[model samples]
Target: MPIIEMKQIVKIFEDPKRKTNLLAIDHVDLNVEENEFLCILGPSGCGKSTLLNMIAGFEKQTSGDVLMNQKRVDAPGPERGVVFQQPTLMPWLPVWENVSFHLKLEGVAASIRKERAKEYIEMVGLKGFENHYPHELSGGMNQRVGIARALMLNPSVILMDEPFASIDAQTKTDMQEELVKIWEKHKITIIFITHSIDEALILGTKVAVMTRRPGTIRETMSISLPRPRDVTSDAFNRYKRQILDLLKEEGELAKAASRSSS
Candidate 1:
């Protein structure tokens, strides 16, 4: 059974000024298996991020259902942790406190929260920097804090929206490796959204390529690559070529449609 399922999901946004409706996602169905890392990939404005937001319960769909753990998901909860592109950490709070913010909400004792937060902080390699605020950390380090914060909740599903998009290439590669290591240890389900085909291939057990605007699933490619994936390997190149071809076709179709509409 899948840990997360979306059945024929549809989302439409209204343009009040233009008196028209914008279709963001079009009857998309998706399933996420337990402990699997699934990546949603597509070009910009393709609704991949929108689909992720719906799963996060940060946005509501026009129709269809989102089910997780055999229960309907109507709103956000601690069970579903989200890590946005930006760190979104509190500037006033130090790294330790930011990681323990969820516990603080539940009225947990300071001592207990601190102890729990320390474990995750160390897990992300920020052991000595707990006292530093968000401003004191580098972009990659801040994202590490975000990841640690989500893991601290022991969430059933971790949702990451292009969390490393803004980081340098070298740092992004490092973070990807770190994420896979953490995932192997925790075995938590993750729904990650990204536009980079390489990122999707490196991280996901399955990659769902989406169509351009009014997005729907174009194809879902299964990846059986071994751990510590070799981005330069022949097999990796084969898959990369295939994904690029698909994206190119989708891009052309999107351009034609826009031209005709205009």
Candidate 2:
């Protein structure tokens, strides 16, 4: 069975001024298999994040159902972990405390929390900085702390919304490599939302492209390229070109809609 499933999802937002509903997702169906790294790509305002939020149980769809492990998702639970674009860590807490916050909430012992945090801290390569506060670490390191915190829950699925979008180019590349390594080692299912074509091509086992507003799955392409993908290779370029074309087409359509509305 698919680890995560969405059938005929439709999301509508009230446009108070216009007094009309704005459709954000239109009859979209998606599925994520176990241990698959699925990347969702689309132009801005295309409901990519909205879709992820539905799976995380942060948003309720107007119609249709979201199921994880065959159970309906009505509220957020430990079974699905989410990492937002920002680190969203507590400023006062040190690295270890931040990563183990969930355990603390569960009433786990301090010693056990510390030990558990240590494992993920090392996994994300923050071994020596456990004592440092969020303000003391670089943006990339802080994001790693967020990843560690999510992983500490041992959730069946991890939902990431452009987690590396704010880091420097070099740091983003490094983090991508680290993320792929972590995914391969842990074999966790991930639903990642991004606007970058190259980033999607590099990280995903399958890339699902969505259309502009009222987003629907335009195409879901299997990325059979081997791990540690070579960005400059012919196969990589081929996939990149395909995704680029799709995005370009969506961009044009969005522009046309805007012009008509104006």
Candidate 3:
């Protein structure tokens, strides 16, 4: 079975007084297979995050169904882990504590939590920084802590929302490489949201290009390029050009709609 199934999913934000409420996602259908890295790419306000939230059980679809392994998603569960744009860690806690906070919340023993935290902290390349606080680390390192924190749940799927967007270019590239390594080693299914076509090309096994709001999948393309991708290669640039053209069409349509509506 596909790890996650989004069937005819539509998401609308209702307002009692307003005649027209916000309709973010249209009737979109997608199947996320097991152990594949899927990247969702679209313009701002295009419901990429909304669609991800639905799969994470953080938001309910207005209609249709979002299922994980044949089960409908209604609420957040341990089975679906989430890493947001910001690390959002506890300022007072050290890296290890932040990583194991949920275990602490669940009344897990301190010694066990410490050992578990060590395992993931090391996995994310933060072995010696376990004792360091959030403020003590660089932006990229803090995000690594966030990734380790999510991995602590041992979730079946990890949903990320532009997680490396705020980092420096070099760090972002390095993080991308590390993430690919983690995906390969763990064999975990990941659904990542991003605005960068290059990042999508680098990280995804499958890329879903979405249209402007009332966002739906414009196309889902399988990316078969070899790992440690060379962006200068013909195949990489071809995919980039294709996505750029599709996004350009959506941008033009959006502008025309604005002019007509006025």
Best by lDDT: 3
C-alpha TM-scores of all predictions: 0.98, 0.97, 0.98
Candidate 3, run of 10 with poorest lDDT:
14-23
- In model 3, residue pairs whose N, Cα or C atoms come closer than 3 Å (at least 3 residues apart or on different chains), thus clashing, are none
Q: What is the lDDT of residue 234 in candidate 2?
A: 99
lDDT per residue for candidate 1 within 5-80, as digits (tens), equals 9999999999999999998889999999999999989888878888888888888999999888888888888899
Q: What's the C-alpha lDDT at position 143 in model 1?
A: 98
| Models, CA RMSD each | 0.9, 1.1, 1.0
Question: Could you give candidate 2's per-residue lDDT for residues 1-262 as a string of tens digits?
Answer: 9999999999999899988989999999999999999999997888999999999999999999999989999999998999999989999999999999988888999899998899999999999999999999999999999999999999989999999999999999989999999899989999999989899989999999999988999999999998789999999999999988988998898889999999
The positional error of residue 80 in candidate 3, measured at the CA in angstroms, is 0.7
lDDT of 2: 0.94
Candidate 3: list runs displaced more than 4 Å: 17-19
The positional error of residue 105 in candidate 2, measured at the CA in angstroms, is 1.3
lDDT of 2 at 33: 96
lDDT against the true structure, per candidate, is 0.92, 0.94, 0.95
How should the candidates be ordered by TM-score, best one leading?
1, 3, 2
- Residue 8, candidate 2: C-alpha displacement in angstroms: 0.5
Compute the lDDT of residue 100 as modeled in candidate 3. 97
Clashing pairs in 1: none
